[model samples]
Target: MSSIIYTLPEGFTTGTDDTLIYFYTNDRPSEKNKVVFTKNMLCLLQNGIKVVHTANGKEIVTNEEVLMLASGSILMSEQTVANKYEAILIFFGNKTLSDFCAKRRLSFNEKSPSKSIFKVPQDSFLKNFCLSLKLLKEQGNSEMNEVKIQEVLNYISTTSPDIFNRFVGQALAGKSDIKIKQVVGLNLHNGLTTEELAFLCDMSVSTFKRHFAALYNMPPQKYFLQQKMDQAKLLLSLQKRPSEIYAELGYENLSAFSNEFKKHFGLSPKQFQTENGPGEKAFGLPEQQFFKDVPATL
Candidate 1:
């Protein structure tokens, strides 16, 4: 079997079964999308599992339900089939998790603080998440209640949402020079105003925007709001209070935050919490609201 290795830039844990993650394919066809799956599968990436499919004499990732496989390719997998191909991973076993970690080739120790990275063997994550997903199989969730699922999601969010926010923040903030070897990069604050940030970065306002744009798509001011919103979505998912989130975001007035959030996202921040709080799985809200701000060139 051909194995793919990834030097993960962020740490991740999934909150629920409805969430699917993509590491390398940002802004590509295979970028994040809502997927359909029959059997339960949680694709965790400790060792990078490359899903290849063959089409027109080449490997291609076919468009299928949750798992898409390219119809053509030659490889050593007992599970291989035509017209469909996908990667499976299992990390429950100690050896399995170790094998995945062996391939994390990036040196994250270059920074002041080291980020703790962990992964489930690919199949392990897939399976565990599926087992947690009672809704996917249409299984009666009369037994699965909010409090229990929230606890699982809370654990996943503790490790991942912050990491994802860090990635999006670092990219949006134009911090290419900073060696971001881990997901949450030392818990650095990303919400900085252009005026406030220029002073912090030791650059003049004009110079800051110019340098910042090179690394991030837009100027820092616009990007900061978007980044905060993304983080807020993740927070809301765990059933955090809107008033607290507003305070956590350092907004003096909750009403102002709510209005802008509603204008930008098509739903008030409070509405988002109600609609998608724990089990709605509405992952597309932020993208729809803030994608317009990304530089056209990006």
Candidate 2:
């Protein structure tokens, strides 16, 4: 299980147990910031709207809606249409969910969805359930917090079996041996070291490399860098500023980003943007020779 605890800056209040709950409100609107979720996150939006960009697509979340983000990274930008941004959030680690499943005797036979973000369909039962948890917090019943967590899991299992199965599958996926495709695609935008990624995949460095090489027919490092470059080109064609996108591409500094771009595309980001028009392909998706051999999850 991941032990990374996300501690927000000052003015953010947190409640904790096996799961971490954050009550967040920001006076100022947020700029597009890169956020890495080390654990799966479920948020109930009480006010304002949040727009998130993942590798797959964009999601717009608003009040009365629930959003689930898989354990990975995303570029998030927020806007407050009327009031300040406020939300009740739970960050659930795999170990916690696995324990919950063990206690409930719940198991899933299906695979999780490949898309990183899921907008949970809301119902009256879910709304009342969330409200009851809110009341539990107001009443200072800290001892019942775990009960509330179980209630949420139980509600999901009964009302939305597909989502419940997906959650279960995700919980188990972290512990078992997953495919090379799942690990690489999910972490393409992540900046973890090779050793760190190997650890996350439950493999030794040597084993991870051997499997990765067998699948991609290339070194993992080189293959990932090429993928990042290709994604950068796509983002640039959409007129995103290099400064705004460099960090999301996992580059630490602008100079290095510029150097890498020039090396790959034969022009600086700005120059390329100025010279080449939009809708041109930088390259076509890194050969994709083994994609047919790999089936996407769900």
Q: Which candidate is the best by lDDT?
A: 2
* Candidate 1 Cα misplacement greater than 4 A, ranges: 1-176, 179-191, 280-298
The stretch of ten residues in a row with the least summed lDDT in candidate 2 is: 2-11
Residue-level lDDT tens digits of model 1 in 1-298: 2353221111233333322233222221231222222211223222222343222232223222122211112231222233333333211221211111222322222222121112222144434654455353366553444343333333443445544233223222333233211211222234445676666656688876776676456776676677667767767766777887886765677897788788878998778878875644446444444445442211
- What TM-score against the true fold does each predicted structure earn? 0.35, 0.51
Clashes of each: 18, 0
> Which stretches in model 2 have alpha-carbon errors above 4 Å?
1-17, 109-112, 177-298
Global CA lDDT computed for model 2: 0.69
Residue 179's lDDT within candidate 2 is 42
Q: Candidate 2's residue-wise lDDT over 1-298, tens digit each?
A: 2334333321143433346666667666775576767667778877788898878789899875788766776777777767588777776766567555544556564465566676676577767876887787788776776667667767777777777777567545645333445556667878777887788777899998887776568888988888888778768766688999999999998889999999987999999877655554333322244234433321
* Model 2, C-alpha of 278: deviation from truth (Å): 85
How displaced is residue 61 in candidate 2, in Å?
Answer: 1.4
